[model samples]
Target: MVWRSILLLSMINLLLLFSSPPLRAEAASTSTVRPEFARKGALTCMKCHDDAAITQILLTPHAVKGDADTPFGQHDCESCHGASPEHVHSRPPEGALRDPPTVRFSGPHPSSLAERNAVCLGCHENGQAIHWTGSKHANNEVACTACHTVHIQKDPVLVRDRQATVCFSCHTEQRAQSFKPSHHPVREGKVICSDCHNPHGTGQDMMLVKDRINDTCYKCHAEKRGPFLFEHAPVREDCTLCHNPHGSTKPALLTLGVPWLCQECHDGGTHAGNPYNASKIFGNTLVAPAPQAMARGCLNCHLQIHGSNNPSAPFFTR
Candidate 1:
């Protein structure tokens, strides 16, 4: 019993010396953290948040880093946000976008959102996000912090699916459309809006990443881009001519196939009634003479059908 008591006393003393809460309090009290321990900041933030998350946010590759090694973080957030001189005493208001009233951080008050943006833009203005000022997202009061959590590591912006979900929250109509039987499978993790648009902002009305709408579609449907020897005027001009790409009851996502699909923009010559001698697409086009052969439809001769590059091919024929 005496030996056990002695061992227990020694263990308690070791725990008190090595794991003392006072040691941590003393370490955090200094204005400038020691250089060796400078890689991490927001010491108070890590009490609830995981250390791995805090470390990852600090290590992000943005031009302006929040890492302790960086001058901004090394000097503490107060360097830019201003010192929270009075925060230690009085509590700040709720949902504060800016630093608490107690803190001397720069105020978004009495200034336009543009002015608040200019503060951070001083260093980060050269990147792809520079055009975000004129973007629809900016106009909607969707500030930089909505989709981004600087305090949270693994920033949500990097997750493509999550980013799309953020857009869906606002564009619920598109979300409903995606749930339909025929869609680009956006909800299935197959497609995302950012694949075609620049979410930060764009000059295009729809925020397309490219100057032309076709340019955006070509990213995934490169086959549609062709300089064929015999080009279909509508096909060359726009992809939406025969198809409702979003969702369609027609096969291959076509708006309508056979006579209907071709007839919308295509008019028949002076035939008495249905003037064409041959059949229409997909079906027999007419009667291919043999009922059995009608099952194969217009695909018979127009095999190299989409657009043929052959010099001798007439009417884009095989």
Candidate 2:
């Protein structure tokens, strides 16, 4: 009986092994490595590129040969520029784009947008670029090279102070807004575009850093996030309902004057539509304090505009 049990276990192991799929071997690289470009020309990168020229890429991390991930380490120039045997040997026909080196970024006859991005994504697909294929930037056909300069020691877009200029090139409306009197500190460089946005691509709309607008605002304004008994409805819904995120002419970036802004929603009862005049402020000593028209308006009584934890302050009047 013991021998029969052992035989049964052996058969089960064999069945399990056969049922599992075999592991796939890595595919052989299709890119041909051409050493002849360096050897036949008897040239280094500086020979053709010159010290003050594009060969300044050597100053960047891409030129570090010890790191296997970079282009220079992998296939020298041909890693990014495709193996162009013909480019090295002879010139093309007249009027034909004859600039040697397989990948040309900026020229009269540059590589197509897809081809250029493909070269980048080939190595970067596993990094921050993993979601790039379906992202808004990708959908709009925005190339990776559009915002990045790989050959330089320092890309201006990567720096905080200079990054806004890069984004403002396409987002002209935002540039105008940032110039308004009531604006975020983008010009001062205290707040940058990347602080609220992720250009690489996020699941949220507008490439926002957070999934919700209020959540993004609460990153700095945590006092407004509350579970109070008396909550302002619009405050819970969206900040943009009352405030302009970019910039505004009014204080606190308010979309409109207080009573008018409040009247947009709360148009009811006697004083709701009342306009402020000389009589409302300095005219008469009436029963209650004069209608709140001059100072702070609705906020004079409704101090808890965001929310109220007070049990007696249902209208947030306290």
Candidate 3:
């Protein structure tokens, strides 16, 4: 009976050895089949990603097949998304999610931030994006896809009317300010955030399109850009000193109403120091109230408040 048991064990071992070789061969064959670029390019991707949002990319400039600089001209979707033969061909285990593409822009399991941005920089590394390497957005790990939507007919960030909405997603404070009584006509679609700012990057502070705040303001307020005989020191230094470019409760986007705003800097002797109050109103005071306390306040006399080209108007009152 012991000899029979030993013989049975030996047969079992031989059966296991014979079965293991096929398993090893199968594993080796699978490993050797590396992921590669799909032969049909966007056609292959369209088989799975046939939704309106994904297919809308065909209408964008990036899909111009005639232009070799474009994605569709190169390897279509694969140019930006990278090769994904494994994702295209393989099936996930039962009840498990399928493997993602090699470089997903937006999803639950996206590629590394650097990897996502690297794909964009590979093509858009020139022009406005030249300084993007050391830019505030890049340093903060802000992805290119954060502001740009590639799989769309028109990228909202690139559109003048809808641009601020894209920027307001991250700049919530600016959105609140934009709704204030006084603003830069941003909501009216007459002005846009990109008019003053360069989201890609800039060598200037606040990522302003121009080198200085005053210069940026001058883009629209060209009349203020003057070589006047009398120049307002604060106006020349920075527009933001007296003005809130985003928005304000005061008229003309002024940081404060008239005398209050002027008093911030001109708080010295004379009427400039006197605070305008209800007590100094026409009926409340025994003495005639100062003109600085009335309608338009400091601007009542100082008509050319920005600057006066008139040689005699030393106080910017032309």
Best candidate per TM-score, number? 3
User: What are the root-mean-square deviations of the candidates from the true structure over C-alphas?
Assistant: 9.5, 15.2, 15.5
Q: Which 10 residues in a row give candidate 2 its minimum summed lDDT?
A: 21-30
Error of 1 at 124 (Å): 3.2
Write one digit per residue (lDDT tens) for candidate 1, span 225-275.
887777777777766676655666556666665445655654655111232
List model 2 lDDT by residue over 89-198, tens digit each: 55778887554567777777778899889988888988877778788999999999889887777877888888888889898998998888899888666788888888
TM-score quality measure for candidate 1: 0.62
lDDT per model vs. reference: 0.54, 0.72, 0.80
| Each prediction's TM-score versus the true structure | 0.62, 0.77, 0.84
Off by over 4 Å in 2: 1-43, 51-53, 91-98, 275-290
Model 3 lDDT per residue over 135-221, tens place = 899999999999999988899888888988988999999999999998878866789998998988897888899988888888888
RMSD of 1: 9.5
Residue 97 in model 3: lDDT: 80
> Any idea how many clashes model 2 has?
0
Model 1 residue 35 distance off true place after TM-score fit, in angstroms: 20
